[model samples]
Target: MSATTTTAETAEPAPVHAESLARLLVAGERPPRPNALRTSLTFGWRAMLKIKHVPEQLFDVTAFPIMMVLMYTYLFGGALAGSPTQYLQYLLPGILVMSVVMITMYTGVSVNTDIEKGVFDRFRSLPIWRPSTMVGYLLGDALRYTIASIVMLAVGLLMGFRPDGGFMGVAAGVLLLLVFSFAFSWVWTMFGLLLRTEKSVMGVSMMVLFPLTFLSDIFVRPETMPGWLQAFVNNNPVTHVAAAVRGLMQGSWPSMEIAWSLGWAALLIAVFGPVTMRLYNRK
Candidate 1:
């Protein structure tokens, strides 16, 4: 009878001890919640690593701008400004803005790719803030945008496009372009969540971007268009961004144009950020 009791007591203690050990192990394995900045940086680093593995991912940013600058300056320079040098001065700023804005669409395309590949599920499983993933996507693309800007400007300089705004003005123009690009990224991010495939997101993004960009003063003066088309181009947000960038590069900052561009950026973020967050959470 005593042997039976001793066996039971020993077996009972083993189960309790096993439970205690399990609880401790679980506590150790669970990571502590990270702060927002740290979480964003973590995901941003993840994005950089992804880019490192696929350096060819930057071909659009690097090659597209160079090609556009050479083609447009050579093709349209004589007709537009009587010389390639003069036209480059006019075309580079607008092209810079257009190129950066166009690249922003990739942010959404990448996010959609992650979703389709079940990466978002893994991200959701992590303890970080949900928005951090999206923000990290944006942060990661920021480097790409900056690289595009530098490449475009370098090509422009080689092509004899000198900015009257000099260094400070050029810096201001680049800053404004970055701000607009960041805001534009959110629009794509929202689309990424709503769309099913990366290709669809990119298609819709280009469809929307091409029209706005082509119709705007990025390539030609609004006054040159039909009255109705001129009105639309004048009101287009891309027009304002181009105007602001041009003004800065030309050393004549247009206050009204800058204000309008900033207003549009604020409106984009206010409207799209929440919508994206809600959709992302639903997924």
Candidate 2:
């Protein structure tokens, strides 16, 4: 009877070990393949649904762009760029770039809010693809950015800022701007995850973004700046992005600017994507 008891006790551990092994296997399968495209689309749709339900978020989607267009095109366009017409032509591209940059702050804010509220923890417990959550958020945010871009463009058109590149060129410019914004979002995502509060994410992102935008040739030609500032502006990633947009809108060939913008975007994505994912997994 003692011998039999020993055997049963030994056998009990086998089931426990098997259960543990199974759990480990499940944990190993936690993230799944990144499936960025699929995840982004799903998240984008989710964001759209949220907008549908709330409706008020569209206020920024509509009002901010119109206000920015009018303020820049009428209020400061002439003072900054020589005349309202010429300035509108110049300012439109910068405003578009600014709109894209400004919209990404919401990405960080939303992600931070989710993290703080234990929403991400709930998501982690689900059987869904892990990166899908992040991708979905980004995709939905991109839709907001797209709407903002359209509003800016429409207002620009109303202000007599015709794109020399026409529809195809304008579309290309918008596409590049979105890609750049998407890539830049990684840094903000990292910030959102690292920071304790959504407000911190907003503050840090804006602090970083302000210098990047101001130091670039967004509002004026780079050569017009002093030697040191000009050098920095010439090398700034925002400069590359802004120049690429300007070239596309103005019907100018943008091979170099495009290459630079894409290079920066790709580099940022490579660096921040894995880090953000690791942080997410830890959370």
Candidate 3:
């Protein structure tokens, strides 16, 4: 027994060679590279997974919208519209747009966060569609925009906010908002790639967003503003977006405004999409 055990213990293992080791590690034919849609969707799923692991990220889409609806509805309600409930009719749609639009900055923040963590370096080295990564960020953020809109709509309904356009109209409005948001996100994503830090991204996004959102028809009518302010407010893309949404909700079907909104959304994508990709490629 001692002789047999010693022989087993001293037995030499098979010699390892590079070619044989590679064969053992090969995953068969290296499946064809994923297409852009597949890769983008995969990255989008990865974003959702991050949200799943850290559910606290959902607070902005939920709690923040609620607070905006409540605060704006009550604080300016009586003063602006003679009653809180009365104000909601005019305010809800605008607030909804404002809430969702404001949170878009988080896209840049997320991108910068990933870059800081070295996640993007690996992404850059992958043999996949170049724009898929940024597109994925926009697609994942679409869910957030939807959640924020739904939350705002629910709160508005509970507060006696009524829309004449009914469910179909509201749905169409939300669809349009999502479309706009999808295009608008490219702007921030570009900033995310350009800026050195997430904080810089956030700061720049805020400087732009605050003026972009507040200087429009979100809180009041453009006609009521001073001449110079009205010029900016009337031409502001947010004004067109808010007008389109409000009209849709109220069953007005503001075709001109909708066209403007869609046009602006397209323009944003056209201008920023290429810039974002270039920055991404260089980064």
Candidate 4:
């Protein structure tokens, strides 16, 4: 009995190899490289559903434009345009630009919230293209922008504001605004990925955006501003976008301003797009 016990004690268990461990991990897991278009559509639908469930998420888009048109047209209209109706013609386009750009910060906030909640991790674990997540968010946010534009324009129309550019011009203006808004959103996207918290992302976004919107010719003509401020406003990309919209809607055909706005939009996308993606992958 002692000899048998000694022989048993000398016996060893089988060693596990790296390949076996890998196979174990891979077992019952189908690597999920889904089609990119399908993945984007799937995630986009999810974003839309989230908005539907949390209807209050759109309060800013729905209510803020109306308030801005009313308040600005009433309070500043008489002073700026000599009449509220006249001011509406000038202010509507700029307000539309400002409103859409303002809402882009929400994109950063939303992305940051998803990261903090581990949704991005879940997305990575799946076999879908990583960019599909951002594409979907942006596609869904496009609908939000459309809603804001419609509300703003409708309010302006009711308040006796008319766009001399007619329907085609209005369409062109919308297209340009959307293009700028999408490109500008990349700035917030990078911030959301790099920042530690959603609050920080929002704070930083506001700090950057407030200056762009307020300092530009959004409310008044740049000529009325101080010389230094006029120079800054003239160079500000927001000012260019607003001028483009104004020219389109007011039948002034601001071709130069439109070209400048497009250039700025392209620059923003070229610079921030890759940086945001790099940070996203690192995270």
Candidate 5:
């Protein structure tokens, strides 16, 4: 055979490397690291951008706490708790918890909006880690919760609701409240992904939280409740969390309440974190 023909015959196909073979097998393999910080920052910045455009949503965080403090102090303060001053002290913690819980609803609503708008689809199409979106949402929502907590605390202070436990104690209370809110975000995240509608997630989540808040020791002492409801209230996670906050703020360490609240937060984080992640993966 001629030299050219021999060379052509001797030529062989290129060897396939393991990495390329793996890529071919997987077909559109995602990046090994999702750059969690970048995704979180992106998600958080987008949320802030929305807030900048709307600006009114912050009103709820800023004004509602003040309004609640005033409404409870003036209207039912005297009748329920004998004086506005004592009522302010007694009710402020509950108001703080309520404010934090209420703000978390925004997480679900925002997630639902993203899903409905097909933003999540684009995210999935990218090389981003699936879990990063959820983590970013939780981080962003926590910032909103922190803002709401600060606004409520400021309003409480202005309304004569002083923490007898001093600044450190007050800070501890806020931190616990944020921890609980962070754990609760998982449930809301699951709802957002599963429901895919802001109204539905908001309505259902609020309805569930309304009972937990009212039935807990937030608005009143558990002793004041009926026997059956009191049992439930005493056992409710919100009750423990609120009691823990009040105890911390008053400088009276309620160990049992604190333990229970922390336990519940941990349990919620463990259970709902995986569950919500699974739901997100399924989607």
Candidate 6:
């Protein structure tokens, strides 16, 4: 009996206290939750990291803007304004608006891609602010929009497109564009959460963007169009935004256009932002 007890004792492992085991596993108290801005910025950094890893993502911002400036400046210069240099002045700002606006659709594509990869599901399980993921996508794309705008401006300057608005006016114009773009992105975020596939997000974005962009006064004056088309173009929000940006760059304030653009941008955000969050929560 003594030998059997000794053998059993030798076979048993040492007992571990709950306190000691917990101390070994978790060393410190939990840290406070991060603020919304910090969380949003962190997610934004993640988006930027993606661009850093995939440098090819910059092609639309760089090469595409350069191509648009060259193609349109030369193509419409002779026929529309009698000279490339003369046409560039009228075309550059409008092109800047159109290019940046068109690229904003990619924000939806990125969101849909993340959703497809199940990245957003992991994000949702975290303790961070709910809308940070969506906001981060826009913040990242905002940087891209700024880059595309600068590229367009540089190409325009090389081709004799001068901004009479000088530095401040040009800066204000770009700022307005960024603000509008940020608000516009919420619409796509809603679509991103709603769509099942990246391709579907892209298809819908194209259909909406192409019509809004082409039907506006980006390429030509509204009066030059048929009366019915002119009415639509005149009332189009893109027209107000393009006009506001064009006016700001040319040294004209166009306060009414700016107001209209801001109003439209605010409307877009107010309507789409919550819808996106709702879809995100359900998703």
- Each candidate's number of clashing pairs is 0, 2, 0, 1, 0, 0
Question: After superposing candidate 4, which stretches have Cα over 4 Å from the reference?
Answer: 1-33
Give every collision pair in model 2.
43-136, 44-140
Predicted candidate 6 versus true structure: per-residue lDDT over 224-253, tens digit per residue: 889999888999888899999999999999
TM-score of candidate 5 relative to the true fold: 0.85
Considering summed lDDT, which 10 consecutive residues are worst modelled in model 3? 22-31
Report how far residue 267 has shifted in candidate 2, in Å: 0.8
Model 3 lDDT tens row, 193-212: 89999999999999999988
**Model 2 lDDT, residue 11, Cα:** 83
Per-model TM-score versus the true fold: 0.91, 0.85, 0.91, 0.87, 0.85, 0.92
Each model's lDDT comes to 0.91, 0.85, 0.93, 0.90, 0.84, 0.91
Q: Give model 5's clash tally.
A: 0
Task: Please give the distance, in angstroms, between residue 188's alpha carbon in candidate 5 and its true position after superposition.
Answer: 1.1
In model 3, state the lDDT of residue 255: 99
lDDT of 1 by residue, 1-283 (tens): 9999999877853345887788888876656779889889888888889889999989999999999999998999999999989888889999999899998999999999899999899989888888999989888998899999999999999889889999999999999988888888999999999999988998999899998888899888877789999899999999999999999999999999999999999999899999999999998
Task: Report the lDDT of model 4 for residue 274.
Answer: 88
Best by TM-score: 6
Q: What is the lDDT of residue 152 in candidate 1?
A: 97
Worst 10 residues of 6 by lDDT: 216-225
Stretches of candidate 2 exceeding 4 Å from the true structure:
1-40
The candidate, 1 or 4, that scores higher on lDDT is 1
How much does candidate 2 score in TM-score? 0.85
